[model samples]
Target: MIAALLQGCGRGETPVHVSQFDAFGIRIDMQLLGAPEQLATEVAEQTAQDFALTSYSLGLEQPGPMQRVNELLATTEPFAAPPALLPLLEQTRDLSERSGYLFNPAVGMLTDLWRPDPVTGKCSEPPDDESIARLVEAAPTLDDISLNGIELLSDNPAVKLDFGAVIRAYAADIAVANMRARGIRGAMIRIGSDLRLMGDRTGQPWRVPVLRGSGGAVLGTLDLRGDMSVVTVGRFQSPCFRNGKEYSRIIDPRTGYPAQGTQVVTVLNSGDAVTAAAAATALFAAGPQQWGQIARQMGISAALLIDDTGHIHLSPAMERHLQIIDRNAQVSVSPAWQDSGPQ
Candidate 1:
């Protein structure tokens, strides 16, 4: 962005420590400005362990606990898991309910039918129409999955768990929490598309960019002044084609179809990346017409939704936060989400 243009703001050594690694099928870029080397190293190790505990990596000889839960849900018997998973399951259920079932972690069956091979990223063919329809009709929500203590069971055999919707965000939370606990002054943790910013660039807020079509153009800037989360959902990541039509990997559990109609949906919230990430996916699937309601229900005041037509809609809270540098974009502020002054 315009980091050089920024004046009157003095941040000490903007992110002196940087680390790059790959995990959970996505790349991770971490920036730490003022943190001890020994502690930073420990934080990195903890982040990876946390991700492994929460992610559902399939097609491996031994799947993680997330995948194991999916296997249990596929069967009739209850699967006993460690108490560590309680928070993950609990939060996912809350997100699913709040989003009106638009955010579903138990969508493993649906995703498996649409996605390519995880390692090679190639698909023989997309799932047939009949199979998709059948799975969509039978897809189970969190209400169908019961959790008691450390045991989780799905009464519906069709239910399968896939934490794709919010895994990265929650993992970022874990990493951020670890860093903060270890006396890190400021850190930016990005897991795939999930972003979490702690502290500022001296006196200025963290400048975050929202991408436009295919992520080539900058839609605007969301300056995060405090601890907050920002996430974007778009069709550009890991696209698949079927019958000469392209589709995003994200699936709308409500319709059992690969979600479209929105070029990108970016969400901002007070302090957690997981909810922001989940809401972005849910709103992206909900489409332009339904994003306002989804944001309201999820208590997200700041959001930007870009339709396939390149029209940008901003919520009241998001309008206050976003400084649009992209004049070429067709932008509009929604009165439904935010109120105009001097009315």
Candidate 2:
């Protein structure tokens, strides 16, 4: 169990108290603002338990329906139709087709191979290239897995659905929904580094500091006062080896490899943490070129991209929300940045 406590005054009322806990590796931080002490305690305890059950994959001891489907895709021979796996299967299939197979064979295969080891807490590497090549040759198409709520199997079943790219975002969305249902406003939910913000902090923007180092020093800050969901993805907070090899926990579903290049990317969505989370991870994996196209396609409100060179690129929408505070050196937004327009 990992835990941290935050205490600060808000609205000149009693100090706001927030306690974050990670049980079974489902990260959650609960903030009590202007609430009764007893009620806050109860809410925190209950919320923690709820998040642990629904969001923590490791906590799901027995294979739930989802896990069962995942297992089926892993082991059993291909069937005609798998009813339980329909939703995920359909989503995977659609994404595969739309992404022009850029996301299909690679992503799922890699996830299956390098998923974090439960005991070691480290991600394993993919099988040899020859093995991957053979698997790719025998990969199943999206159409192959689309069964219309029925069970189906194929003789060549090399492909599988690895929703690791989207699961954290999904969990964030679930947490936001649950919080809203309970009438909790003016709060932020952070699962690992993914986050969702609801309401304002006493009419002021909620300032979330982005840390570049693992020690949590401020790299920058985002002002999320409105009802927006913000998700950040990067290699910053992940573990690093002394040999100069940095491995991000985020895996690119396409090639079964850890996402590389660029330091960080933050995606802001108006109301969907899940979408924001997915976009952040996907954009990071896709890199800047693909990310720009996606930003235009998705109409993302704002974005911040930091690369290995320490160059910062801010989307047009992000300028309004940025206030740089580099006391030691001059850090300027790039001229090519859309934000640096005529004004």
Candidate 3:
């Protein structure tokens, strides 16, 4: 029973309503608002389709532009020169660099080794130590990979774009762009927990539930208005198990291990949902202290981090926007939030 409502003011029209279904492990919902009756259905359908096409990892199955791109990426030899694959390759390269090469080559190896089961789509146990060591030995670094006009290859011939981290956000960006171009004003696009919201809910804020667990029991809620986008990152959203030990899907590209210590982190920004989501994931992987430093350095607007110790850390900007309704919730506003200039 996933439901959302979008109400408009002075228009006297019924608020747009949307419901979601699970598609390829992603939650997809679409609703039309402030659009003419004839166009609403068309817009909704097109938007949903576009979102699915771009966001679904399995969408790589079809033989289309993106498919062609992915195939080239998958089959191309390490250090091969392929001009057609340059854009995506370059993008991947940049992300790796910006992430301090925290986007490590071993991460992909680990992901493949700890591959999710095809049948249940659940993560299986880590592969044999020999396999892991072989992968690690074969892992490529930025130095190994060179991108000159889209032809990418590692000197060692092992590292490559996993696309798992960036693909969802990329799709969200494309979908939002499509919606705006089609004159759709108010919409929420969520691929799994990665979400993007455009405009306000009419004149009011778009309320988002912040849950404590993957089961969706609410911890708190956020009311985002204007052009802001919100992205939540946490272990609770994507749980995995290995030999009966639980692990999160948020892999630390550096250690080829799952991130630990924090429960959930939310980032709000005026940028696209994809950027927000990616940044949030990276920051979460970086952990709390480093995350705070990065957020301050980047001038990030709002950040909320919930640790395993049941402590909540709110950035200065986030405090202005936060309404902590759970009295029993152990929360602490960061000094930055407390000292943030002039309300």
lDDT of 3 by residue, 1-343 (tens): 2344434424576456464644445567655556655455556666556556654432332344544433444454543454433444456555555555544432454666665675677786666767656655565554555555545544453554455566666666666677788887877766555567787765677787765634365667788765566778777765787888778777765555678877888888877654466567777777765676556444466888887686788877777777777787777776534444543
Cα deviation of 54, candidate 2, in Å: 1.8
Give the best candidate by TM-score. 1
Candidate 3: lDDT of 320?
71
Global lDDT of model 2: 0.58
Order the numbered candidates by lDDT, best leading: 1, 3, 2
Angstrom error at residue 107, model 3 = 3.6
Q: For each candidate, what TM-score against the reference?
A: 0.88, 0.74, 0.79
Which residue runs does candidate 1 get wrong by more than 4 Å? 1-15, 52-62, 335-343
Indicate whether candidate 1 or candidate 3 has the larger TM-score.
1
lDDT of 2 by residue, 61-142 (tens): 3355545444565554654443433544554454445444534432455455544566666645545777655655665555
- The whole-model lDDT of each prediction reads 0.75, 0.58, 0.62
Residue-level lDDT tens digits of model 1 in 1-343: 0011112224544434666666666677776665555566666667666666555442222456556666667787887865656787788789889998888877778888887876777754777888888878886888888877777788888787676677678778887777788887677777665578898765577888888867777877887866889898888877887678888888998778888798788888889888998899899898877888877888788888888888888887787788889888888886555433321
Clashing pairs in 3: 79-153, 86-150, 144-155, 316-337
Candidate numbers sorted by TM-score from highest down: 1, 3, 2
Q: State in Å the error of residue 316, model 2.
A: 1.4
The segments of candidate 2 whose C-alpha lies over 4 angstroms from its true place after superposition are: 1-17, 24-27, 34-42, 56-66, 74-106, 115-117, 122-126, 135-144, 147-156, 213-216, 239-244, 253-256, 327-343
Candidate 2 residue-wise lDDT at 94: 48
